[model samples]
Target: MEKSLLKQRLLELKYNNFQDLDVDELLPLMNAMLKYIGDTDPDLRDTLIYSSFSSLILEGRYSNENLRKLLVTSVSNDYLFYGIGRRQDDSVFKRSFSTLIIALILHVNIQKNFLSLVDMEEVADRLINYLEKEVDVRGLVDEKGWAHSIAHVADAMDELVNQKLLLESYRKKVMQTIINKMCYDDDYYLFEENERMVVPVISILRQGTNQFLLIEGIRQIAEDLREKYSSDEKSCLIYRYNFKQFLQSLYFHLEAIDLCEDIRREVKKALKVINQPYYAIT
Candidate 1:
């Protein structure tokens, strides 16, 4: 289908509240949407395509089998990992938007239980690997729209950790991955990337991750920032500032939530370490 025709059809579907569409009719549209999932046009990609997927999934329009197919396709190279290693390019749209779709699938699965433990584990593994390789941390491109790769993957991880079938080990791995991404040295996250990243941390904490391990993750972030503080390079300073903001934001988030006293205290201690001056007071 041509892009213009697809947009018109999607607009009509949206106008009618996405109702009364037969499965056969919707499938073709869905396939077309998937093809343009990485389109640089914000109206088509975000407003029409992603919003349509979210509405259909939340409305239970797709069957379990269909949802599984969507999940698999979203995680595939054509979508989530498309042009993964390249930085500051249009391909980030595909990868970032794919994570949002995966997140919607995971959210629905938590209630419906259509996905298996193995399925969830694969998602965790793929997401962690994606984060490790993803360098395009661009949030909102000037003309193209949002390419918030880190924030989008964080949303997927947040939903993934909430699955009852997911293993605790995977949760630990997810937490560590989040920390590593927050401390990424390539670029600073001006988007609410830190806030989105914290959602998964809260999810894992609610699932009862080992307090010691959680504290250790905090310490590791602090230690990393300390090492960077010793450097006078401009990039090192950017990393230091970004890392400190994440810790501060996390501290406040912990304060608002209950049953996180130990982790909160550790974060507080780490903040103090982060705030220490490089030179002694006169």
Candidate 2:
């Protein structure tokens, strides 16, 4: 299937709200879409491939077996970890978009109960590893589209953390990984990345993560920001700014939720301290 032909077909499918399609016939089309998942063309990659995948998964168009395959492929090295170590490159589109697919699969699994505990744990582990290794923090490329690696993975983590089958240890690791990414030193997230990241934290809280673990995560963010504050380097300064925004976003999210008053208080205290000038001498 040529790219142009695929685009036209996907456009038609989208126009009809992805209904009445023969699942057997659409299999090849799905493969083609995955083939171009890394395409730099926003219309094809974002509008066509990604949107089509989301509609298909959310609409329950694919069989459980097919969804399982997608879940496997999305987390594999070819997609999730493709060109992973390289920074500020087009390769990010593949990795970032793959996370979206993984997130969608997990979202569907929440209701369908197709995935097993092992499947959930594997995804949880891979996502945390991806976050620790992912260096590209680009959100929206000027011409290509959104590379939002952190935010996309955060969405996947949000879904994963919501799964009751996932172990508490994995959940704790997810919480810690999210906090580490919030203090990412590469670049300041300007694309509401902080807010997107907040969703997983809230999910973790709602899913019954330990209050002590949550409080420790909050303190870790504060301590990381403090260390950055002590540095005069430009990168550290940017990290501080990003960390501040993340803390503020986190505080706002905490306020909206009814759970965890103690954790919310810790975040509030962290926010107050982060907001104060560095040179306060009384």
Candidate 3:
């Protein structure tokens, strides 16, 4: 497939629209198109991604297994993180979101086989780097609608954690990143997305050998919440929900650990205080 021909066919297929088509007719063409896409051009790479997943989304898990296997194998962590397609004016965060979305789809659908094909540490390391670079931490959405980039990273991390694909040493770092993000913003949308990562982050702690990381992170969060509540005018917003969920999850995990009694006492005391009203007339 020449570059010009490949681009033309992609534009043609994409423009022709996603309608009900005979699988026999569409499968071969899509497979061939995916082969030519090989991760060089960002625009075409994104198109290839959309092409790969559109069927599953629109027609219920429709995908060419052999072709998708080839496609997933070709996806590189560098491409996902740094991205080859970002324009001069475009946001890298926004661009990386699409690539990660494609990676998430492949990961969910392919499982360990996909993990076997890629460098799990490299992928996790790059994503953590992106999280650090992220200052705005806004969701892909604007007033127009859903962008889902920031949300996608959280979801991808959740997937990685659930699969036990992230290495143990790096797990604590990932957990810290998420714990920091727990109270990073007040936007309900972003906060809600951040909250989705909490369960997986907690899961890592439960499975990890290090109790200090979990205990310390939870204590800090508890203190953060106590400080937030001290301010009468601080609109804690989604932090209210985040705080409750964090305590519940932390307590659940703390019960399974034998050495964190002091931390537990402090957490339980904070929970009691938070449960009480700001002003009790009784």
Candidate 4:
């Protein structure tokens, strides 16, 4: 393509509102440009592809399938969206980073009309079902796949509850799922050196109301699951991390707690402990 033409095409992208564009015309143009990015020199390829993906995402022309394809293609092209492994960020940072990103992405997706609460539940179900299918003959665990899918489900549930779709019945169902996973968490150390697998169980514990009764009920479930799942003494960091995660989502449990200012203020304290420096949960 002529340099002048390429420049013009890039300029057009800034103004390319897919809602106004003819999809038939735009998709082909996008495809051609994407192909061109592959031929570009390596140094400049990242800039081009990133620009292109940003444009496509902003264009409102892409759906979940397109985003999935984009992720696969981008990674195949050598994008590392990798994070620290379990041994690395022994702090709660990585888990929160993963779960929090999932939550933000879901928020963005819903705003972009690519997904809904119901759609998210289906995604969660599909992810778990996929992991279940990948298990071995004895129905033993696949730790890696389980962790990945469980994080996905937890984020989806967080979004569902945030959106008010996670009613009492659905909440019960989610708790049961985690409860089932307890046997595995107990059987395997899961992570080396006493790092408890905290996200899923913490998530279940967070489903309670703000009221003392509900909070107590949820705490009991958590204690039971902890006993059922964890063999070692509960890791304090893991406990704090789990506590903070629940605190991060504490608003869901607020209906019951609304009656007490003292309890409500305590939620803020919990958020302080759990929230990232840059952003508080509230």
Candidate 5:
């Protein structure tokens, strides 16, 4: 297949709306590229076509004005739905989220309910797996990819939850595309540690600690201490400092009282001892 032929066709489809395109005219183009797209060298082919597809989607690829064109786009997915007899592989070489997004768009736009939860699960799992294991220690993605994995999971999960394929409660709570909170305290750090990744992970978890949990959790630690410390006159806003600081203050207050008592006792002894001897002369 000449590369320019597919490129030229995609270029035309890019500007044209997919909602209205007649599928009959679009089949030969897709049929011609089937082998290449479904290749073992997946990334090589996926990355090249996805760059154009991504640009088109962002540019109103399925807008109402292009409804006819969208029908043409559906033909490719229609082939996928009919089970194009091909070797299935779990490994993804190219733009991971791109295919999923296309499939999701096809599902929603083309109204294909036959596609089950597993299809989306595969995409979501790939996204999390890639971020957890594949992204660099720097949390950077390849320039060829988009940072839409997490966001895509949230989007697709939203659909599944609405469809009842996913439990409404099981899907991760998202706050503007980040994992927001979990109701259960049994799990923490749903993501693996990498500093760049931690910011989103931590910010999202903060919601898990409600006011009741904060007070109760602190109460448990406070009950184990030996001495209770309080000062009304000296300071108002002292922190609960180290135990050593509390112990030193306790001793200082005791020692000051002991010294005052001793001075009083000595004064009484001197007064009693000198009184009788001085009285006769006076």
Candidate 6:
């Protein structure tokens, strides 16, 4: 529990490049040291925790019951770790650790069908809440010159949908949220953060390659912009948004995903409408 001891253990576990810190060794330490794992205050032991969890999840070390309990309890107790319903920027360690945990859920647990002991529905709900409710506190850029909150949320959602961990209804809801956020161009700071979401949102849509969702998402965005433009007396401000570039990115990514013929045709039609004056809508 002591700061010095926590760091020492972490260094020991991290010794020889995690070669000696296998799952068999990690679960016990995590069980005894979960409270001391992350930074609650001056203790900068989060990196040690992050490194340990990263190894555990990435190395497919979910076979142990204690480890499963550790993950579940950590999420349940510390929403900040995963940014679930969290409005402020988490520590760097927490941000990256949250991402690792989500990746573990998507790849190791869901994909490999491991962790039958873990309540995945609860996990899914937490992830969904993270995407739906959490607020961004890390402004346009941190010292690193990029925001991790949106990117992490976007990446996590993309993985879930790609793995079919989320249902169609939930996927649609997430897509709508992403679209709305991206189209809110007036919030330039948040818009830049939303820009980090575009690729992953497109990646998620590419899973179905249906193009219907893409078309609808675009139409909804256009409608939103039209409403904004009209409300502002048809201001040229809407023209400054550069949604055409976004559509071009969508088109390129969808093509890379090898969209079906019908979907491809729909995409072409949508793009034509998107590029036209008044977006061919007014």
Instruction: Give lDDT tens digits, candidate 2, residues 233-272.
Output: 8788777777778877877788776666787788877866
Per-candidate local distance difference test: 0.87, 0.85, 0.54, 0.40, 0.34, 0.54
Question: lDDT tens string, model 6, 28-70?
Answer: 6655445543344323433566556667666766564544665
Give me the candidate number with maximum TM-score. 1
Cα RMSD of predicted structure 6: 5.2
RMSD of each: 1.6, 1.7, 7.9, 12.2, 22.8, 5.2
Error of 6 at 147 (Å): 5.7
Off by over 4 Å in 1: 278-282
Candidate 5 TM-score over all chains jointly: 0.34
- Could you arrange the candidates by TM-score from highest to lowest? 1, 2, 6, 3, 4, 5
Whole-model lDDT for model 1 versus the true structure?
A: 0.87
lDDT of 5 by residue, 197-238 (tens): 223222222323222322232233233221122333222112
Clashing residue pairs in all predictions, respectively, total 0, 0, 0, 5, 14, 0
Candidate 3, residue 71: the lDDT equals 37
* Candidate numbers, best lDDT first, in rank order: 1, 2, 6, 3, 4, 5
Which sections of candidate 5 miss by over 4 Å?
15-93, 97-112, 117-132, 136-161, 168-282
Give the winner by lDDT: 2 or 6: 2
Q: Which ranges of candidate 2 are over 4 A from the true structure?
A: 227-230, 278-282
Better candidate by lDDT, 1 or 2: 1
Q: What would the TM-scores of all predictions be?
A: 0.96, 0.94, 0.55, 0.35, 0.34, 0.67
What is candidate 4's local distance difference test score?
0.40
- Candidate 6 Cα lDDT to native: 0.54
In model 4, which runs have C-alpha deviations exceeding 4 angstroms?
Answer: 1-59, 63-121, 127-168, 174-217, 221-237, 248-282
